[model samples]
Target: MKYSILVMASPTAGQGSATAVSFARSLLARGHTLHNVFFQGDAVGNGLANAIFPQDERNLVGEWAALAEQHKIELILCISSALRRGVLDKVEAHRYERAASTLHPAFTIGGLGQLVDASANSDRLITFGH
Candidate 1:
């Protein structure tokens, strides 16, 4: 099966992010394909490059990055939500005259069109939220 996940919760506040990651891993282990992982609302913060976590806490950003890298998953952040939350790509940063872009290499800052594409292309679109 092909699955796409839409995550709408902040990584630090709830189980949404962790749940999505675990589900993705399980699906892959079961021989499924991940179409995409789309981050919206506070979830876009998951792709921020400057999040700092205590040593005791799991590194959500690093885990997500590893998933994308290892599984060749497409990680997309909602551009409007990300911009409002100060998540910027190099192009967005240049266009808005920002100091620098905070988007990580593991993810891409994109618009709703990507989500639409994912929904159309994937067999299932699952949402993880509060």
Candidate 2:
């Protein structure tokens, strides 16, 4: 089966984003294909590369990056949401005249069209938050 995931939860606040990652792992373990992971709203925080988690806490952003790298999964963040939340890629940061970008290299900034494309191509469009 083919699946695409949409996560709208904050990366640091609650379980929604973590649950999405775990669910993605389970899907892959079951021989499912992950088409992409779209981080909308607060979920875009999951792509922030500079997030410093405490030693005792799970590094969710790192986990997402590793998963994407290992599985060749596309991790897409909503461009608008990400920018509004200060999560910029190198190009975006330069365009906005910022000093640097904070987006993880594993993720890409995209629009809603990518989400639509994923939904159209995949068998399931699973959403993790409201």
Candidate 3:
């Protein structure tokens, strides 16, 4: 099956993001293809380039990034929600005259159109949190 995930919680705020990550990994292990992973609302934190988690704790952002790279999956951050939370890609940072892009390279800033497209293209669209 082809699956797309929508994450709506911050990586550090609760278990939602972690749950989503585990679910994604399980899906992949079971031979499912992931269409994309969309980060919206506070879930945009999953794309932060400067996030620093404790040494013993799992780095949710890094985990997601590694998963995306390893599986060649699209990791997208909702542009509107991202901007509101100060998460920016190079283009957006340059356009807004920000000091630097805050989102890691693993994630691409996109509009809701991408989410809609993912939903339409995938056999399952699973959302974590809201």
Report, for every candidate in turn, its global Cα lDDT versus the true structure: 0.93, 0.94, 0.94
**Model 1, C-alpha of 66: deviation from truth (Å):** 0.2
Name the better of 1 and 3 by lDDT: 3
Give the lowest summed-lDDT range of ten residues in model 3.
121-130
- Model 2, runs deviating above 4 Å: none
Cα-based RMSD of candidate 3: 0.8
lDDT of 2: 0.94
| Model 2 poorest 10 in a row by lDDT | 11-20
Ranking by lDDT: 2, 3, 1
Backbone clash tally for model 1?
A: 0
For residues 1-130, could you state the per-residue lDDT of candidate 2 as single tens digits?
Answer: 9999999999877799989999999999999999999999999999998899999988899889989999999999999999999999999999999999999999999999999999999999999983
Q: After superposition, how far is residue 126 of candidate 2 from its true place, in Å?
A: 0.5
Per-residue alpha-carbon lDDT of model 3 for 29-63, expressed as tens digits? 99999999998999998999999999999999899
Off by over 4 Å in 3: none
lDDT (Cα, tens digit) per residue for candidate 1, span 1-130: 9899999989988899988888888999999899999999999989999998899988889899999999899999999999999999999999999999898889999889999999999999999995
What's the TM-score of every candidate structure?
Answer: 0.97, 0.97, 0.97
